[model samples]
Target: MTLKKLASRAITEIGAVLDSALPHQVEVMAAPILNAKRIALYGVGREGLMMKSLAMRLFHLGLDAHVVGDMTTPPLGTGDMLIVSAGPGEFSTVSGLIDVAKTAGAATMCVTATPDGTVPQSVTHVVHLEAQTMANDQEGATSVLPMGSLFEAVQFLFFEMVILHLRDQMGLSANAMRANHTNLE
Candidate 1:
């Protein structure tokens, strides 16, 4: 296949996944975030990179968002939230951190492909994003992208949409979000 063809296929696949998301799902993911006093996000591997991207955007929207394991991340407690990605549905580290956050009186939200997975089952809320992940990316996989790329790619777009929803919901202007961007960059 040509490079352009591959890119188009990938883009179309991502669009399908995003289209599958219900409006309620986006609201489910955003409501707790808006209610939280502090937000900590986590994921493993490439999914972690996506979570970090979301944290950055949330920060730019004037929210107190932090990535887990960051040096400056504050402790999560009452009125706080932990947003985690378990694309394949269960990561040991993700589960462990969720436990800790819940024990500390923080709400937890999980983004997952398998809503039935143990991690998702345990979380306070879940946003199900149906896409091919490492969990189901073996023989006969549906996505052209390898391993969890489909899930991760869909995550990037999904998170961006969530950010837009949040910005609008919070009555924030694009300029307002821009103002919160780091000057050091």
Candidate 2:
């Protein structure tokens, strides 16, 4: 396929996954975030990177957002939230962190392709993103993108939409979010 055709196919694949998402997914994910006094997020591999991107946007939206392993991530407790991605449904570390967050009286939200996965089943809430992940990417995968890329790509777009929703709900202007951007960068 030509480069442009390949790009178009990939975009279409990602869009199909996004379109499959439940209409309520965004609102379900955003509610705990808006209610949280602090929000910490985690994921593994490329999913982790996507989680970090969402964290940055959440911070820009004026929420107290942090990455789980960040040096300055404050401890989560009541009125706090832990958002995690487990595209295949479960990750050992993600599960452990969810346990910790729940024990601390915080809510946990999981974004995953398999909502029935162990980690997602354990979380306080789940946002299902139907896409190919490493778990089932080895054979007869639907996406032209390699293992787990579809999930990560769809995830990034989904998170951006969530950010936009939060921005509008909070009555935040783009300039307000920009003001929160790091000047040191």
For 39-158, candidate 2 gives per-residue lDDT tens digits of: 999999999999999999999998999999989999999999999999999899999999999999999999999999999999998998989999999878877888899999999999
What local lDDT does model 2 show for residue 109? 95
lDDT on C-alpha atoms for all candidate structures: 0.94, 0.93
Clashing pairs in 2: none
> How many residue pairs clash in all the candidates, one count each?
0, 0
lDDT of 1 by residue, 86-156 (tens): 98878999999999999999999999999999899999999999999998999889888989999999999
Best candidate (score: lDDT): 1
Q: Can you give the TM-score per candidate against the true fold?
A: 0.97, 0.97
lDDT of 1: 0.94
Q: What's every prediction's RMSD, in angstroms? A: 0.9, 0.9
Q: Clashing residue pairs, candidate 1?
A: none
